[model samples]
Target: MPPPQPRTHKAKPPSPEPRPSSSILLISPENKILLLHRVKTSSSFASAHVFPGGNLSSQDGPIPAPSSPERHVDSPVYRLGAIRECFEESGILLARHRDGGGMLEVPDAERERARRAIHSGEEKFSEWVKKMGGVVDADALLPFTRWITPTSVPRRFTTQMYVYFWPLSGAGQDAKIPIGGDAMIPTPTSDGGLEHTAAVFQSCATWLEQARRNEIIMFPPQFYLMWLLGKFFEEGKGGAMELRVQREKVKEFLKGSGANGVPWADKVMSPVPLGMFEGRAVLNLDHPGPELKGSGRRGESGHVVQVRFSKEGPRDVEVRDAVEMKRLMGEAKGKL
Candidate 1:
């Protein structure tokens, strides 16, 4: 028998660098935001209902200098990726006619075909838009916030969150606007049930209630953003009034938050795990992470999220306000 070879342990590969990605909160005119349900077997955010987003591609084009000192170095790339992903995953193309006539009007059949071609790499997104004689309406995306995945995760992404108020003007006769109005809006549909299972526009509060009741899983970022948005549109507002009021209110917020044309302003969040509360993990929403010390970016303090993780995925998310978060943390520290 051959002598046993000396045992040698293989060294672990280095963790991947955080990829630049973008997510869009597609705020409908009806005071709701579009959410896509990821398949349960997804590599990231498995089984979670999340905003439309994906990693940037080389076809997204070269990164420009920060739009302002407050914007990330890759802000332009992020914006492009956000628009492409939103269209690929949700069938809502954010672009306009090349001659600046108005929004690009494509039949649903053509839209679906183009979406498949772009998503499958048969053609680049930019090239496809140009082929259709349109320019991406990236300017319509308003910077909402940015989130860097925690270091503990094996795969990480620096995702820029954007708010896009879908315009319902100049729709073709074949458009499907769920609301009772005659105005036509781009219909949202899943990408052939591949990456996402469903694409639906539902109110923030309704989504929050669903997550709270364990009907769907939402990661902390989605949960936190929805919690913030829920504060603006209450439940009792009437139909069209709710839409108009919410649109104006959100526009005001974006204008106020994104003062001086700096992306995200002070709303960069890098959650740091402080401890566990009950069976859930408690994270410090305000921490800028060790890598970002002295970066000057800050999240709203005194707010925390409790999320439970299982082998399946993250579930049971709860965002605690200042008072409740203080009580929870104080009790954990034996100071309450």
Candidate 2:
């Protein structure tokens, strides 16, 4: 008999931790949502139409106590980060005057200067707002949803999504504080083609249609959220909904739970991959990954979204039912 050899095992690589990040759906007074076209050279989410947001920074704020029920853990920081990133990426400051003058009103030249300074890290975001005699409208950002990147991905993030009703047409009667007029509405401008190429506002249906036709690229998250937002608008109505009325309807939806009694904000979505269909990745929003199964933390089921992956970026997003998704996946598997 040959000499016995000691057993050897290959160690598994450590899983990447999900970085805390925040994004905002900036809803215009006309009910359109702002979407930024990311630079093609960017490392992540390159060439995709995404919401304004970035990673949570240390200067955002201190984390909250985990046991606190009033607020989600690190939500204050997330909100601050979302506002800052929004300003940095789209030049739209979600801020109000400190003197209770509603939205902050400053000359366009001054706003651009401040934006440049903040983007260059020459000044801290919160300090600049305070110096300008304004306060960040953090509370304006309502908790919309949260997405956790799948474990299979090399780079991961825990992104907190929020919705901010930018009163471009003026704050509605339902608003507690009296916000200013059109002068206070900050215009959306790209960051000199640094990270974003353009900042555009279009109806959710328009964006969804573009994505469906492969005209623009939208990742699974943005695609799914836009689909949900489209429901609030009337089809073939020229996307005409008064600002006040739209704000009230959105507020009601955010306050109440979704299809079930469970609040949408409470849901921590981690879409589980079922299979593939026609070169597209099919993800199941109803079920979290195997690791998250029985965790009781992931919230209610939503929709099934698919995206065709490419070397440049993802494209051709579509929403389908579970049965149709399974059938497509089966056909794709058989083709292989």
Candidate 3:
């Protein structure tokens, strides 16, 4: 054999720096919360459930404020991004009147102008709020939670979660209302862009039940929030009025000791847990439809065939082959 060649070491590739993400959470005046169902066509996390929020933009930076808000402004970028996303995704503007009444009302014309400004890229949120006689009510937004996507994930966000309550009106209820609306009256809609396909109202109990039963697909933040909400409901004597009080307590709770217990930490384990699978099944079956195979079918298609094992017994047979005749017959009769 020839003399062994000298070993050569290969240089390791450089590790990529982490990217940050941000988001906002809005609860309507009706006590119904808002969430987004990501479109199946999305390039990132397609078909996954999410909130009405997004990553921070370059324009998301400090605005001159006469007084410092409750949140940190050193990175006003994150706050600004959160406010912008709240508007973009949920039609809830975390802004106040120039006089400081903490109310949001814009006429049709003004609403249109603001929308135009945002669309044209000429309107910065801070400047627009100031010009339109409004202030960024970052104080009203409660910093509920924060999350950093795991490094293993292809896409990530250093998301800051905020919760805010907004007034509801007929115009606000209009799902087609444009963001910022026209000057006559602010028309807030649930059409929160492609990132959100549907927005609906449900109580914390309802949300938890759905999540627990796997009726809805939610990410960590959403899942955690729902679990926390469930605890609040549980603590509230299981009544709507008590639940409302518990809802208000959330802001204080977040600022103090954080949620009583993080459900994700306590509940989520093993990538493929029974809870997650059950949730998936529930979400899949949410709509009106036939039950799954093992659940039993209804109607004329419910017939079952019985097979007898003879003395020749115990021969292995493929179910697919056995079902082929039945399948073909069903197809021929248009019963499949």
* Candidate topping lDDT: 1
**Candidate 2: residue 136 lDDT (0-100):** 94
lDDT of 1 by residue, 1-336 (tens): 999999999998765556778899887756678999999888999888999999888788764322334234336678889999999999888888899767777777888898998888888998888888889989888878778777778888767888887664455325566553744567788897789999998889999999988899888999988887888877667467566777778677666642223334346677877677787888777765444557766665757888888786667888877567667777777953
Name model 2 segments beyond 4 Å from true: 1-7, 63-74, 171-184, 235-241, 258-261, 287-295, 323-336
- Give the local distance difference test score of model 2: 0.75
Q: Best to worst by lDDT, what's the order?
A: 1, 2, 3
Rank the candidate models, highest TM-score first: 1, 2, 3
Each candidate's number of clashing pairs is 0, 0, 23
The lDDT for every candidate, in the order shown, is 0.77, 0.75, 0.48
Q: How well is each residue in 194-287 modelled by candidate 2, as lDDT tens digits?
A: 8999998888989999998888989888898778777785444433344556667777877777543567776667777776776777887765
Greater-TM-score candidate between 1 and 2: 1
Q: Quick one: best TM-score, which candidate?
A: 1
Q: Show model 3 residue runs off by greater than 4 Å.
A: 1-15, 62-75, 108-120, 167-193, 233-244, 258-336
